[model samples]
Target: MASGKWKKRIRRAKGGHELEQAAALPYRFENGHLKIMLVTSRSTHRFTLPKGWPMKKRSLADAARIEALEEAGIEGKVSRSTIGHYLYWKRLKRVFIPVKVRVYPLHVQCENARWPEQKQRQRKWLSPDEAGLLVDEPQLMSFIASLDTDHRA
Candidate 1:
């Protein structure tokens, strides 16, 4: 469990400042080259990282790991420290709310044969450069392009 800001919840606020979420940046070193995994959005079928709201009784990193498993069917080691963060707009019924996401680095161990949301999402592995093209957020695109080398397992 986490305390302080990580534990706060806000339904609505100005500039979407009250909205915060956790995201998993799934990656692996493939033959010395970095590869990132992107999943299709259920409604739009657009590409994006696997993300969701924080869950009760879970660390933000653990919450992010669960999102990866549910949305992309991948399991792996998740870093307690965030690699970085980015902003994105989440579509609701009649409004698109901005969300600030803290990204946890996930070193993918394996993709499951079956998992939740498997029927609703499609997963693809691409180079950091390739992944950047499909990722809509400028900050996320830059984050992928850089792909910080100093990650701990």
Candidate 2:
């Protein structure tokens, strides 16, 4: 439903510029140790953080929170200020989408929630260094590094 609406919106945009989006990486501290959740694509099975384009009529922060729940299947408090953004090309139509992702550092308080879409996907809990290496983008790696530092402090 939302994806269909998003496709329609994309069609209506001038010059076919993709809409801005936001995402979140949920992390938590248990016993004074920081841990983060990473998901592997069911298709490619590449480990990465949860992310998606924001739906129409939704705030960036709200969208990020939704993505965290839908993609990562975890609910937590999301930060107001964005950590950073990154850009990449979507191979579906060879369109270069500039995604202004807002990194919400979530403090997860629970787990074992329902995530139907991500059930086939592999999930793992790893340290920040491991997460940084899992991400392909340099900027994203840097962002994860900063998050690691923040988690430590």
Candidate 3:
């Protein structure tokens, strides 16, 4: 599967590193213009993509799709190939763990009114530039900027 290739592409640390996560960049077309979806983080409430720890039994892409379903209440075709990767610090108890996130693009085909995190987080559909401004992570912002061209291609 492409998972092996994805693993090979990751730059490993010489000694050790923080855990990795999977995320989905959900997008859809609105009046021929591409719009991307961003969801608020549960605690920090920052605008972010749907992401979570990797699921042991599912491929990374599948895990990404699951995250989107749970966090954004959306489902769609997820690309097995990763669009890109990013690093972010996740707060845990007393420490901030650096997390490497593998991102997959999901062409959202459905949005459920009620889903697992519907009450916990807010979801919004914004233009690529608008979405970029909403996100805090620099890597994520670049990814958002690239979404318009990537989605078309």
Candidate 4:
């Protein structure tokens, strides 16, 4: 009972599974000040860490590195160990999809890389406490707190 155009539209409307993503929390001590890199999205301008879905041909760590450079404009060394994982609902096709995220701790070497392609992106270096508060996820906040405590010891 539907037209060709309507059927095509319906086919396109079916949503797929939520993609997997990896994120990095960059931390460093600069001149006795604790600093972390936080990024604002290009579309939503939501403040978050640098993260993205892993590329088909690349390892998860490499994808994390590339995300940091593209999103935050920073080059850093990522730890081999995973800090933690989290889950959230992502909106797609007017439905809430579940997404799994892996988090890694990065030792940032440079914070001032240029990202002309990301016109709406913004990066800031905030103290651990401030960064923890800024992050939206509770699990991520706990990880940041733990990192802060570890740094203090």
Residue 60 shift from truth in candidate 4, angstroms:
1.3
The lDDT for every candidate, in the order shown, is 0.84, 0.71, 0.87, 0.75
lDDT per residue as tens, model 3, 106-152: 99999998999899999999999999999888999988888888666
Query: How many angstroms is residue 61 displaced in model 4 relative to the true structure, after the best TM-score fit?
Result: 1.6
Q: Which residue window of length 10 is worst by lDDT in model 4?
A: 5-14
Which pairs clash in the backbone of model 1? none
Query: Residues 36-108, candidate 4, lDDT per residue (tens digit)?
Result: 7788866567777888766789777778877888788787898777788777665544455566778888888
TM-score (C-alpha) between model 4 and the true structure: 0.80
Give the least accurate 10-residue stretch of model 2, judged by summed lDDT: 89-98
Model 1: CA > 4 A from native = 1-11, 14-17, 148-153
lDDT of 2 at 100: 48
Query: Which stretches of candidate 2 lie above 4 Å from their native place?
Result: 1-18, 93-98
lDDT of 2: 0.71
RMSD, candidate 2, Å: 2.7
Write the number of the candidate with greater lDDT, choosing between 3 and 4.
Answer: 3
Please report, as a residue range, the 10-residue window in candidate 3 with the lowest summed lDDT: 6-15
Among the numbered candidates, top lDDT falls to: 3
Quick one: ranking by TM-score, best first?
3, 1, 2, 4
What would the per-residue lDDT of candidate 1 be over residues 1-153, giving only the tens digit for each residue? 244433233236333455878999999877777789999999889899998988889999999999999999999999899878898877654566678899888999998989999999999999887899998899988777766445312
Write down the worst ten-residue block by lDDT for model 1. 1-10
TM-score of 2: 0.81
Give per-model TM-scores. 0.86, 0.81, 0.88, 0.80
Report the Cα lDDT for candidate 1. Answer: 0.84
Q: For residues 79-107, could you state the per-residue lDDT of candidate 2 as single tens digits?
A: 87788886654322333344545576677
